[model samples]
Target: MAQQTASPDDSNGPESLYILGPFMFLGIVFFIVRIYTRLALSYKLNVSDYTNAVAVLAATITFGLFITAIVHGFGHHSFYITPEDSVIIFKCLYVVLTVGLFAAVFARISLACLCLQFTTSTVPKIILRAQIIFQIASLIATAVVTWIQCRPISAFWEAVPGGECFSPPQSWAFTATGIASDLVCAVIPILVISKLSRSLVERCLVCFLMAMSLFATAAGVLKIIYSYRFDRDPSDALRDMMPLFLWCRMEEVLLIIACEAPFLKSSIERVLRRMGLPVFQQKTKDLNSIHTFPDPRGSQGEAVKKDKGMKIDERKLEACEYTTSEDSTQSDESDGNSTRQQHGEVTDSSQSQPMSTPMDDV
Candidate 1:
């Protein structure tokens, strides 16, 4: 048995993956907390809501991979290429691809949930269904590609004594297909959102949701670029770990937050209002004042009629009081004949008289 030589491109050195691990773990924790809070507050937390479950599961898996990569990176000091090292690297790449595909599916589902909220028309419904079907097909394709990438799945991790693996180009092809599906999933939401009829505020909110898909797209692109670099030289350890694993983890974190943005926004608004912050006062005022008048012949007729008459009479009295108070204040201010206090008393009396009006039955 000969001592296997490490590849020349394998630069054994410290890398960014070690530093990214804990942060990715923290992101996973935060994602779980947010999801739990949301579920506790919601009417019923249904797994059938594919968006929520996918976001959560994707985050969990990504976090797990981040930890696995970190352990591998730290445990193996030599970033250089040994036959054993190549096995670990390829296994990590497999995990990265798996997490990326799951995250992409989750992102698409989240966007679909947003579309469902805004769209009621047949066309949008059909489009949404088509997107979902396409996503399912893409998932199946990616799964097949993943399994086929390594003929015997154990070859991906457990190195057979003399067994050969597929070339890097084959791996790259599978990766490229996964990335294409990711871009499709991300862009589809933006298209659906653009067709929706929404107020400026609502549109902005939906756009913000759609923008999250971009993170996943970027992750896919970064992974694709790095997959080529890794293929070119398997020994480029840092290149192999950082973009391939870190970006995918970051994408999962971002997707979780983005999917929960609407719930988070309302929670923040509620907290701010409780703290006496003037956030959304205008919107709140409009919402509070929106009311439908009762029909005269309905059960609410007596109360509605009384309210209407009282409103009219109060307005008339308020106008008369304002006129009298204005005249008295002007006279007092002009001649300097009346004491300021006495003039104020007269104005107050006139204004206060309206408060004493009787509200006997009509």
Candidate 2:
């Protein structure tokens, strides 16, 4: 097989790097925000948090793989690359892109885990589980079929191992499943948050968190739209796929940030405040909101009096979901108190209904 390193004159090489670099940077920033907020504010770690961490690890590996591919002559027109380099690029691309797809899968799992915190009924749980199972199955199927898409499996990167294969249709199937998975994951959270019993302001806060998924879904949609450009030019597969890989990496970044957004809202708000933004500081729970004073007559002539306000217990505020006071709630599970989290705001739930712990594996 022929072999050649990419030249400085190869515009495609630079273009591909530029496309992925920004997203890779933004994704790193979001990942940091998530880790800090969960540890500093929540003071507890959950399964979803661990999954996001793994996604970051996978992203880092994929980035290194991309660098290797570039060094091996990817991003050049087929004519500019040696047969040997083509084979190297093909092998690296197989692993790197596959890792990227699976990284996105873990990110999606993190989102689902966070969203699971909000579910109220058995049916929703079952549905969520089913969707997750289906997504995993489809993704695994895509990976396996792709690896074996051509018989004498080594045909993927080595033409010397020539064999007949039906990969185009299988590739399309993979893309379809990916899109379906993203759409379902994005839409379901919206539906769950929409059904919350909170006031419009509170509901909007949660909706905004869920909207991250919608934004990432849009990114995935863009990738699908541009996929045809790459699929149509097999002769220029390496060059054409550069744009596709760009979209793919961006989608990964968006999904990772979206998954982290729910947990990082408080930290972001604090950062804005430190930067001199006009932010509402959560303090002293409104006496009026917690509960109405008992009827005056019920006090048996010990006139029911309303205290203008009570200072917030710092410990409670700290224990509550990422808020400071009026916007937060803290409770002790042993006291049979329930906590309801609406994105960045978690308040002690008035009702003592049970809630499920995060199931990280999904």
Candidate 3:
């Protein structure tokens, strides 16, 4: 086969680094800052944080593999690369696709875990858990399909007599499922935000941040669309499929960023408060809206009755920055109970104790 000359419009691979480099940098920076805030500010980590960490790890590895692929003629015309470089590029791309899906799934998992903290409702929990299970199973199947997409496996990277490859739909099944998962993760938080009694500013802020996951979904859609272009020319696959990889990276990195943004917002609020700045506090209309769970002892009504003129605790309100109030709830309950008792209205001690909700302390 005579090597075909590339056209003027063909990409030579190096230019991709400029776009992907800054994306990877921002993602790693956000991941580090989130970890620091969790440890130094909250002094704790939860399931969500740990899951987000896994996402960051997988994404970082995928980014590294992407750079390797670029060096191996990823963005160039197929005939422009030597046989050895082509093989290397194919192998690197295979790993990138497989590992990039893992990053997307884990990022969605992290966001769902965080949203779960805001609601004890059984329906949303079931929905989120179901989504997680579906994503994991679909990705596992996708990985298996990717491994066997081309017969003998080695045929995936190197040409062999009688080698065969699966159709595109088989390879794209997980991507469709992934888009669904992203939408589910983003929309669930909006439902939670609607029921929250926070001010319009706070509600809008939370809604906006949570909805940012849709950008990843949009990228996934574009990835699928560009993938169809692969059928345009088999000999020009390296150049033709470049958009697929670009959109794939964009989808993964966007999910990681969107998942972490809400937590980072809370951390920033804490920092601003510490510096004595007038930060936007989570304001509630009444005691009923502050806690998600109902009082086990029916003390909520009693507390409200005793403190009709509720004194908004700046300390408690300030600390309840995120969707859940794990830190400030106990203190607020204590303050309410003491004031009630100080009014000389004696009640049964056993049944009148305040409720304590156990949540992922943001």
lDDT of each structure?
A: 0.51, 0.65, 0.73
Q: After TM-score superposition, what is the CA distance of residue 40 in candidate 2 from its true location, in Å?
A: 2.5
TM-score of each: 0.58, 0.70, 0.76
Ten-residue region with minimum lDDT total, candidate 1: 353-362
Best prediction by lDDT? 3
Candidate 1 lDDT tens digits, 200-264: 45445545654565665676577676655554223344444455556556555655555554444
- Deviation (Å) of 337 in candidate 2: 13
Cα shift from native, residue 118, model 1 (Å): 2.5
**Overall local distance difference test of candidate 1:** 0.51
In model 3, how large is the Cα lDDT of residue 182? 84
Q: How many clashing pairs per prediction, in order?
A: 0, 4, 0
Error of 1 at 117 (Å): 2.1
How do the candidates rank by TM-score, highest first?
3, 2, 1
Candidate 3, position 242, lDDT: 75
Full candidate order by lDDT, most accurate first = 3, 2, 1
Clashing residue pairs in candidate 3, if any? none
Candidates 2 and 3 compared: the better one by lDDT is: 3
